[model samples]
Target: MAADTAKVDPMHQFAIEPLFGSDWTFAGHNIAFTNSALWMLIAGICLWIFMIGGMKREVVPGRWQMAVETMTGFIDDLLEANMGKEGRKYVPYVFTLFMFILFANLLGLIPLPLAMAGVHAFTFTSHFTVTGVLAIMTFAIVLTVGFWKHGLHFFSLFVPHGTPPLMIPLIFVIELISFLFRPFSLGLRLFVAMMSGHVLLEVLSSFVIDAANAGPGYGVLIGGPSFILMIAICALELLVAGIQAYVFALLTSLYINDAEHLH
Candidate 1:
């Protein structure tokens, strides 16, 4: 009984099980809809409703409208601060990325039951693949914009402006490696943060449940404090979700700036 109680599988929460009756594969790929896909779809739809459905020109904006406006203004300021006037052209893409990520992170925090019977929640951002793809997309945009604006001169990004002739080769190698690692770094930061936080919550929750089942004395002594800590962690995770989204967007904008200006 004690052994069973200690078998808290916090990592089980991250499993990507098929949503339908069974797993389906088409051609050579397992493209069956999973909890991750479902949560992504949910996040996308929620963002659409919050941003597009609320766009009514009113003297006094409704709550939804105000929320939409606030988000728009915040992104606008972020872009302007990072990328200057040229940032306006990329607003649609950057804003969409920001909103999708923000919604995805927030949606993951919601305890929604999956179509699969056992799973209770899905955190799309906690998956490295999801964040990796997003980071790659951002990197691709930076490269495309840089080459389009500056042609082969975009290669100058890897070369520092003021370098001793002998040190130029070494600096280029170092800078090139740093530039190439951006996507991995960006993706890993978000993935690790989300996954670790959720795992911690799951572990704490399991302890609380175990303590509650033990006895009233154990519940008051252990479960109560565990529950309170879980709540505090959940609040911190909420803030972390927002901060990670903002950081991702901000870094993308800064990368765009580097690409455009080429320091």
Candidate 2:
């Protein structure tokens, strides 16, 4: 009966509950702080500490400074590859974006078991609402830069140079649609990728627990394999977290490049 009573729902961990209270309102909308928000704040703080550590200005750099400089250099190189020297000016925002997403993704995999202690370890990137907002912000910047720099000529982005008259309309419509759909794809990609890995880990965890509770035979047969796979997947999730962050920042730079160069 005890074994039968134990239950596991893979999606349970993603639930967002108000940490302070749900009464927070602004402009007639609930704006209560949540587990998701708490984690985001934590990530922001961690990023700040990371950046501040790099400001030591020591002639002989330590590992802390090196790590920070490495990340900054990597992003700078990425932007340069995508946008040339003009990309240097955009480093602050892009670096922050990359580190924030990287922190959010890695923090979610800390294995702290906060839920068991009546605390939640939230992954904001797993939520479409959060990811979508980031994507929209990047997209908004691209649009703003495009229009600001080129004025109405920004529309030329939808029609490549030397586009034949007959194909211009079709190409323009296709390009416009593909451009507009980018935010949705960007958001959905990160949200689904992050959420799916966590879900699989949760499901395998249930198998490991319930199978072990069943009997030694089941434990060896099912629990063992599930536990091993879970560990492997957990490690893979770490790599996936970094990859997702890199991809998000990379795409942002690419989109910004398009706006800058209109190519």
Candidate 3:
């Protein structure tokens, strides 16, 4: 039974085989080209084309300009709601993040040349390397902007305005922990949501297939429910893609505000 089950490669569900030789060389180093890179490239290109190609403004607004404007307006509202009038200054960075993550998540949704998060044998979305990079980037941005705006006073963020003398040390430690964990929390939230959605889709679909393989009548009965679940998961993923992007961007803007004002 184990051998028979092993014969059915779960890896095959994500049909995108690696794009390089076994000794996949990159800059004289053997580096395999996984589907993650392919999708990341797709994400990058999609962002470039949409942002640069669409918003070439002149006199009257074109279709692309209108579309771009709509997205920007939505982001503007998000910033305004969270950070008030002061938030608009951070819009450029926030919007860029929104577009990048938006495209990345959207690209993952399509069953094209790469595995969609949970569909892969090992959930790529859960890969800490990717999440770590995102976390580091956000961390660096917060540090850079904070230091630039407040210089040494940015450290004061960890020093609360109202604190008892005895609790000062304890408060400082707590604030340090919270500040340090911000990027990790942000990245994990996005990764977990995407990974879980894809996993559900694959598991449900696999169950249906496996059930059918067991017996024709059993397969038929399971097929309807399993397929429905798969479709619903796919739809949920669409929402996840948008929401995750927005959430990431929103957090980024909030971080920027923290930096600028040190509050």
At residue 55, candidate 3 shows an lDDT of 56
Cand. 3 TM to true fold: 0.82
Q: Candidate 1, residues 93-203: lDDT per residue as tens digits?
A: 788988898888888887655624665768889999999999999999889988998999998898887888999889989998999999899889999999999999999
TM-score (C-alpha, index-matched) for candidate 1: 0.92
Where is model 2 poorest over a 10-residue stretch in terms of lDDT? 113-122
* Between candidates 1 and 3, the lDDT winner: 1
CA deviation > 4 Å runs, candidate 3: 1-18, 21-32, 56-59, 84-89, 113-126
lDDT of 3 by residue, 54-135 (tens): 5588567888888888888888998898788988877787787788778877776677433344343333344556766776
**Superposition TM-score, candidate 2 onto the true structure:** 0.97
* lDDT tens per residue, model 2, 135-181: 99999999999999999899999999889999998999999999999
Candidate 2 residue runs with Cα over 4 Å from true position = none
* Cα displacement (Å) at residue 69, model 1: 1.1
Best by lDDT: 2
Every model: Cα RMSD to truth: 2.3, 1.2, 4.0
TM-score of each: 0.92, 0.97, 0.82
Candidate 2: Cα lDDT at 169: 89
